[model samples]
Target chain A: MTDTEKVIEIQVLRYRPEQETEPVLQSFKVPFTDDMSVLQGLQYIKDYLDGTVSFRWSCRMAICGSCGMMIDGKPKLSCKTFLREYYPAGLRIEALAHMPIERDLIVDAGDFITKLESIKPYIIPKEPRTLEQGEYLQTPQQRDMYEQFSSCINCMLCYAACPQYGLDKTFTGPGVLALMHRYNADSRDGASAERMDLGYAHEGFWGCTAVGYCSVVCPKGVDPANAINQNKMNSAINYFTRFVTPKGGTK
Target chain B: MSKRRPYVRSMDGWWKRDAYFVKYMAREVTAVFVAAYAVVLLVGLVRLAQGQAAYEGWLAALKSPLSLVFHLVLLATFVYHTWSWFNIMPKTMPIMFVGGKRVQPGMITGAGLAAAVVACLAVLLIVRGVAS
Candidate 1:
């Protein structure tokens, strides 16, 4: 609003179910500081320009993983990505690729949520330890197995980046599979054999063609590609050794 | 049924949209050249079993300039295949832990490529030994 203040163009993909049949790019010019994020630009648009602009955000610090969108054809957290990076030029924002757009910059995350729950993102101890049995202890060495994979924030940015998921929604894409790997790699968890059944399915680890773009777009450094591909080897081994080892081989 | 219509974006030519995807497609297409090389070797093997005259004909074909060009193309594709195969080895394989620390992905790729070079050299030496 000042003379010295600079303005930037933000092109947002708008999709209102009642008003518009399909998503359309709507442009807005907003004044912003260097430290302002792309999320803040959207906030400015909502506050002054257009109130109908709908998007999800909470914590606004990348932990909630809600404000994920395609910023210039790349899946990134709008909260973490600064507006200065794409300033002066036209900054195009769209709902995450390969997902059904619910509204402006909001994709339907129902599929991702369902897949997350289906993977059972918690440990199922072999023998249920009661309160009397103290805690399930894990050494630093054992923790190293699943440490890298455990950092996933359930942001579906990796899903947005994955082509296989775009081609086939049935495939248990990157984030959920990585979370499944997290629980499976736990030393105290005995349900890896159970989880391996899901991993062994056609829509599981085998579905991944190792494009590896999932890891590149990850904000949490989750390396979902490594998780999925590693399980592919595990699935291959289980398929080969199933006859010899009883109970479908060890996890 | 609910009356909610969500717009799903068309992913047509999505691979062409990103350079990373184009690289992946290129890597996948290398398999065709690898299969071609296999077929060439198979043809040579079949000719050897047919007769001495047929075997000599195959060898003469290999000496042609066109065949040399084809071989050069094959070599180029094979080199790319070898590099990409090792580059992705760390991701496809299980994570390596050394002395309670995780092994670096670069180290894994470098080691795989080195092993592949050694194996290729061994195969060449064995083929030379068989010839002389």
Candidate 2:
């Protein structure tokens, strides 16, 4: 429409379960500004060209973590990836890697939801207190122990980036492990023993071969690699000391 | 009974697909060389325990051109293994709280590498002093 405005071709991987057995790429030329994100480009295609092109997004600022997809074969938040950076290149967009495509750019996240729930992401208090009793207090040091891991927004980007999770869905993945560490590291939480089966299992920390790409692709800096590897030490210790220590003494 | 059929994509040649995965594969492969060198050293120790003739025979075998090239490749992979091992040392250990602050990861890796270098040098110096 304009002489100076720039447009780039975005090849989206389309899948409709009822219509297509396999996913195929559909290209759309989108007019873009330098500041436009990949998510914005998909929005343009959905709004102008194809209303049936489905994807997920909420907060455009990368906080809601619903807009992750495979941008040029890497798991990334479409809201954070700028289209200008990949301009003039053959930009391929697909549903997140290692996930089943529901339709278009949306992938089924039920497995991830199940894994997240199994980790028990909330803090189980060390002791019970009466209603009239004062709230549990924490020092800055206590909060610092698990503060970085608490930043995960359940984006599932790390799971897409994890090769172990791709190869075997049974392995409890980086996001869940990081949240497990988050609660375990909390000074007031005492449920680590309950979660030890997952932490020390063959499908737990040992499943990770320390590929460490999960940390690289993490949008929230949760560093699930760090979480998984740190738990390797816990698992190793538990492996040797379990014979001596009584049950419910993993801490 | 269920409508869900999750298409599981095969990840064959996944290492070849991306540079990140290629580097990861390379790092993982270093373990092979490390194990090979361990076996070589173990054989040498066994030869030494056998007798002087057996020890000299093993030394002669080690001096062959093929063995030299193999050792060179082993050295490269061992160095890579050391570098990668040191890099991930911080991740494997519990978080260090020094003076009410978390220690930086770079510091942990740097300290580990420095300690390794010092230990290697100390061993070399001791071995040379013993020979002299």
Off by over 4 Å in 2: A246-251, B1-5
Query: For residues B38-127, could you state the per-residue lDDT of candidate 2 as single tens digits?
Result: 999999999999999999999999999999999999988988888888988877877789998789889999999999899889999999
| lDDT minimum window of 10 residues, candidate 1 chain A | A242-251
Best by TM-score: 2
Write the residue-wise lDDT of candidate 1 on A1-251 in tens digits.
78989899999989898889887889999999999999999999999999999998888899988999999999999999999998789699999999999878889999999999898789898778998989888898788889878888888999999999999999999999998999999898889887877889988998899999999999988889899998887788788998788765744
Which 10-residue span in candidate 2 chain B carries the lowest summed lDDT? Answer: B1-10
DockQ of model 2, rounded to 2 decimals: 0.61
For each candidate in turn, the TM-score is 0.95, 0.95
Candidate 1 lDDT, B1-132, residue by residue in tens: 766788888989998978889999999999999999999999999999999999999999999999999999999999999999999888887778787678998999999999989999999999999999
- Please give fnat for model 2: 0.50
Candidate 1 — which pairs collide?
Answer: none
Deviation from native of the Cα of residue B91 in model 1, angstroms = 1.0
